[model samples]
Target: MKLSIERAALLRAVARAQSVVERRNTIPILANVLIEAEGDEIKFRATDLDIEVVDNAPAKVERAGSSTVNAVTFHEIVRKLPDGALVSLTDDGASGRLNVEAGRSSFALATLPRQDFPVMATSEYDSTFTAPAPVLRRLFDKSKFAISTEETRYYLNGVYMHVADAEGRQVLRCVATDGHRLARIDAELPEGAEGMPGVIVPRKAVGELRKLLEDDEMKIEVSVSETKIRFATPEITLTSKVIDGTFPDYSRVIPQGNSRKLEVDASDFARAVDRVATVSSERSRAVKMQLDEDRLILSVNAPDAGNAEEELVVAYADEKLEIGFNAKYLLEIASQVDRENAVFLFNSSGDPTLMREGDDTSAVYVVMPMRV
Candidate 1:
């Protein structure tokens, strides 16, 4: 097989393909991306057994055939090639090695059988729908930061995507909970999605799917089944196995009747939470919040370290309240508020509190309180 591709075009495709290749490999071909040339195009495919990605780019195809090469080594070689130079990749049908050539640079990669690469199985999808890129972006972007890293629960390690009624309107919803904090987001449902099954899209799929949804105006075609889910654009189709576990019933954890209300500027509150947390040790990140008529005092005290305190003017006029929360959790939830003020609802010193974006129900959050 032989093909000539410009250095920039070759490097962009190889960089994307190699980033998916892991550093350690027990299987030889798992570290390679199969390259094939036919017509005027060349295709590059890479996989780690569970996930596979293929990129097809226009090239000067010659000799029309396929070969496998090390993804990292080939990418490193192409990256060093001089700008505007023409790169030619060639391998005899049975040489067992692929030769790369530029103006004055040369390298050979050991080739493997292209037929040995594993591809994901295709399935009959139970549902298909389309959503705007930004709609899907907000669904995952706002909630992914709260995804649990704990492997024991496995189910909580991903954002739960499903259809639910929000404020008397049918909306596509995403919910993620780590038992201590939860993010619930609602977006308008697309057509033909009324019967979509609730699927717990895994963490890695959520990340891979994010790259395809960057264009704010692009419409994404999504397919779902009992065991697998697929997301596609005109140029890319991604299919992955869904986690085979039931997502916990998250609605019961959402607080409803918290009466004490505190309204403060979101940026001011986040800065105060961060500034006071400087004195906290890793294990104990509890930040004590003292609320009076219209003043909020944020303080942190660690015996081994020093102490920190900051004050913020808020709109709280309820009875005096003192509460403690994990500094990290507070900072995360506060960053979700896009508006100027973040409204927090409290019940008592020991109850889960509710947070929302300035009276908007579309995006709401809940956090369990911690003892100081």
Candidate 2:
């Protein structure tokens, strides 16, 4: 394949495509990015057999052909090219090398047959809908932190996305949990997404999708099927297989009867938790919260590392409540509160507690308490 593309445009396309290519691959061809040049555009495709990302950039085509080369190497070469310089890529099928040239720099990358690259098969989507980039970004960004990393419970290793009833309205929802903490976020359902099948978007796919949502004005087209899910923008398309498992019913995990209320500044609360946690042991980072009237005190005691306590004036009017929680969990959950103070509802020191930003029920978090 032979084509000339602007350095900035080429690097952006290749960088997005190659980010999914794993450096170490059992199959050599899996490490290569497929380059196809035709008409007035060039396409860069890379996959790890599970997730495939294809990006297209406008180019001046010299010859219509295709070639495969190391995704990482090609990305690095294009990245180092001077800004505004035109880059030329030529493939000598006979020599099995792809030549890259920009200004005074030139290098040839070993090539593989384009036929050896494994492209993920397409699927008949059950539902397809469009959403504002910022809406999708909030849904995934708020809940992804709780996705489980345990390989055994594969179902919990991704964000569970589906349609559900919220406050008598059907809303699109994303839920994720690692058994210790759970996050549930809801957005208004799109017109064509009523029949969308529930799918567990794998952890890696969630991360890849985040990069595409940086542009708030961009509209994303999302397609979902029983086996696969695809997110597409004008210049790029990302496709991945949905985890083949059933997500457990997570409704029971969200505490409903917890009524002891405590409202505290989210940022201040997070900072206080961090300071107290500094004295906590690495293994069990437990922080005790004492609440009475309008006062809240956070304390941590580690046998070998010493102890710390900090008092903060908060809005708590219920009977005195004391609870212990994993310091890290409290900090993470508190950070999600963006607009208003974080409101914490407690059932007891032993039951799961609910937290949310101000009075917004759209996004709710549940955390199981730990014994101090």
Candidate 3:
């Protein structure tokens, strides 16, 4: 394979491709990226057996061929080259090496046979639809924070994407929970998406999808099947296998009858919780919230490490209520609120608390209380 590509274009493609390659590899070829140069463009493909990413970049192709090289080493070499320099890659298929040259710097990396790389098999998608980048971004960004890190409950380690009935109309919804807190976000369902089967997108795949959603004006093509989900754009395509388990019923976890209401500035509430949590124990960073008529006080009491408290004037007309919650959970839930005021609906000191952005039902959060 012989091709010349600009440094900027080559760096962008290799950076994304290397991210999909796992650092520790039991199979030798799994750590390398397959490079194919043909038809005035070069394609970089990398996979970790479960997830695969292909990136295309325009280049000047002299001989149409393919080769495989270390993904991390290739990326680092291209990243250190001077801007605007032209990079050339050549493989003779005899020396077992891929030559990389840019200006005064030259490096030869060991190459593996392209036939050894495992490419993910294609699937017949059950449903395919297009949605705006911003719409898809909002659905995943707000809910991914609540994804579980525990490995035993593999079903809860991803965000659930499916069509849900909100009121009377069908909408696209994404929900994530970790047994401590939950995030549910909804968007208007796009055309041809009504028949799509619900799938649990793994946490690693969700992080990779965020890179494709940065363009505000671009539209993303999404394809879903029983076991795989694919997101594609003009320059990049990401394919991954979905979690092979059933997601638990989450509707019952969201409280519906919380009556007491308290409205407070989201930024102020988050900051006060952060400040008071400094004195609490690292194991259980609990902050107690004491709510009265038109007033809210946040306090943290640690017998060994002293105590801290902060008072904030809020809008609460209901009866008195006191609740305790983990400070980290409170901060994450409050940050999801984009609006000025965050509305909190409390059932009691023990029941789960519901929070939303100033009466907006599109995005809701639930956090379980902790005993102080």
> Comparing candidate 1 with candidate 2, which one achieves the higher TM-score?
2
- Evaluated with lDDT, which candidate comes out highest? 3
Each model's total of backbone clashes: 0, 0, 0
64-98 per-residue lDDT for model 3 (tens digits) = 99999999999999999999999999998999999
TM-score of each: 0.94, 0.99, 0.99
- Candidate 2 residue lDDT tens string, 160-215: 99999999999999999999999999999998999999999999999999989999
Give the root-mean-square deviation of each candidate in angstroms: 1.9, 0.9, 0.9
Error of 3 at 14 (Å): 0.7
User: Candidate 3: where are CA atoms >4 Å away?
Assistant: 281-283
Better of 2 and 3 by lDDT: 3
* Candidate 2 global TM-score: 0.99
> lDDT (CA) for every model shown?
0.86, 0.93, 0.95
Candidate 2: minimum summed lDDT over ten consecutive residues — where? 277-286
